[model samples]
Target: MALWILCLLVVLGMGFNMVSGQGEDPFGPEGGRRREMVPAMFIFGDSLIDNGNNNDLPSFAKANYFPYGIDFNGGPTGRFSNGYTMVDEIAELLGLPLIPAYSEASGDQVLHGVNYASAAAGILDITGRNFVGRIPFDQQIRNFQNTLDQITDNLGAVDAAQALARCIFFVGMGSNDYLNNYLMPNYPTRNQYNGQQYADLLVQQYTQQLKTLYNLGARKFVLAGLGRMGCIPSILAQSTAGSCSEEVNQLVLPFNANVKAMLNSLNVNLPGARFIYIEIAHLFEDLIANSKIYGFSVVNRACCGIGRNRGQITCLPFQTPCENRDQYVFWDAFHPTEKVNIIMARKAFNGDTSIVYPMNIEQLANIDIEPN
Candidate 1:
């Protein structure tokens, strides 16, 4: 028997917000529901999926800083994108409300789960732009551990254990490590290591970090590999005469492939640990190859700034934004629009064992499993 459940969360952004049960939104009853699902979700990763762990961190991508959350909760929460991320969508699809920011760590946020992801974080200790002062994935793990301890202090250990097992732990970062270490030549970390060596260190760090989360009582996880970072407008600007850069793709493909291999190896060695890969290769490539199919009209250009270093230097208070943000694939050079994240989340949530690996988030949540 298939046990599935679905949840809905309706966030109202400016013009892009879609009514529930219809239109472009992923969680609002448009996609079929799941039954007996995980009660909550937690996320850890970069800008592509952060839900404002950068709230207290000092950085430019800080979503909790200002008009950022003008739409959602009336204050910025450091989410980076326009609105919503894979974590938000999945939480909605699981029949739960949006998991509160980890800093909002009340038993209230713990009702479903809490988001521990910081925008500049990576799988290793050395990722993210220097000007941006990254919160390394290991340090983020420390925050998660503290969050657990706080929960234990309040909810006790058994509840915390159940929370760890029944909730979907989403990991969607690590791109910045490569980006800062290899792509952007100006960083000190890049000058310190060759591409081959840095990539090797990155994978090793990712392996150990995932292990750390497991040791902390996280049982189910969704690991999203790097997508086509080469195709982003920022990279394209730096390419041969403003064209799509194949060199960036070179870095992405091998890194993502290795991530898959690492996950497989982890499954073989770690008992009771379940995981799924988000297939970022196909997802981003599909968006690039067929933009309209993904409902994006301007796939190559950013909806935010004037291009080039728009991924970083833009998002100013004076720059003009596009009229129809829903049609665009990107909000900034590096981050996807809310619409794009919704689709990605839908793809992730709807994935079965065949696509995601061992068990879907639903099953991993222990919503329905064969008796032991």
Candidate 2:
């Protein structure tokens, strides 16, 4: 009995380490700086980067179960990443816990932040319907407004406004609008309109959507632009005998460039409504150009299941899993590794945003506080 107890304890100890990040935060904001007040972070987007809203729905793209969270959290917490996501990292920077998924019943526990993002969702509803019945961006807004009302109804309008005014909203979607929605289906008018025209329509709708959110009290926005989809294992597999499709790259460039322009236009329109774009293209490119520099040994393969898209072919209850997940750069064909999301999130806030705009999430969150 004594020997059995000792062995049980040993296994439990290792399990605990795998969960709660071995009781240590990989990116705990302790590099000689930290925020004073906690800021709310609201997120909206798709599966290439969902933090768990899809778990609420009956979809295959969902990532709210076991084995998915084996790396960092030890158990599944609905996050799409192996553990934490970009939104989680951003919330940590603000001294807040991970943002709750909208599908969760405990949004009130972390009322300051909530994620309406669903895996496979997109800017347009058509894109979401392409893969699964995802919560469209517009519906995500409805959920956000409802969440605000929940706080206001209980805490009163003044308190709710005060809570939201200091909030930070991060939007990281649009890939599906091109991938599953416009380009893939039977030739539609949008597809024939050329990349520039298609991007314009997307920007117009996106701009209108953000304006609507601002009207509802969104002050700060961190928009994550199109990630490196051309470099995805799935897209690469579609090429001639395992090569990256340059055609995919050709399609992605115009959309990304247009997003930058539209973001600039939105910032110009909204006063005191600061906007920052998280450039994911170059980030992924770095992973390919120099893998060691970005901490990814395998730049194009996924770590789960089997086949080109990493079990996406037969991704179900009985698929086989890869032995070493840490060796791969992707968790699935479309999404990134948990470690990579951390790097991208850190760079988004601390690196170029500071240089590109002379301000960042760190500075904005700490604007009202005096240095200690």
Can you write out model 1's per-residue Cα lDDT over 264-307, one digit (the tens) per residue? 88877877777778787677777778887777788877777665
Task: Give Cα-based local distance difference scores for all models.
Answer: 0.65, 0.65
Clashing pairs in 2: 47-120
Ten-residue region with minimum lDDT total, candidate 1: 5-14
Model 1 error, position 292 (Å): 2.0
Candidate 2 C-alpha RMSD relative to the actual structure: 10.2
* Residue 344, candidate 1: C-alpha displacement in angstroms: 0.8
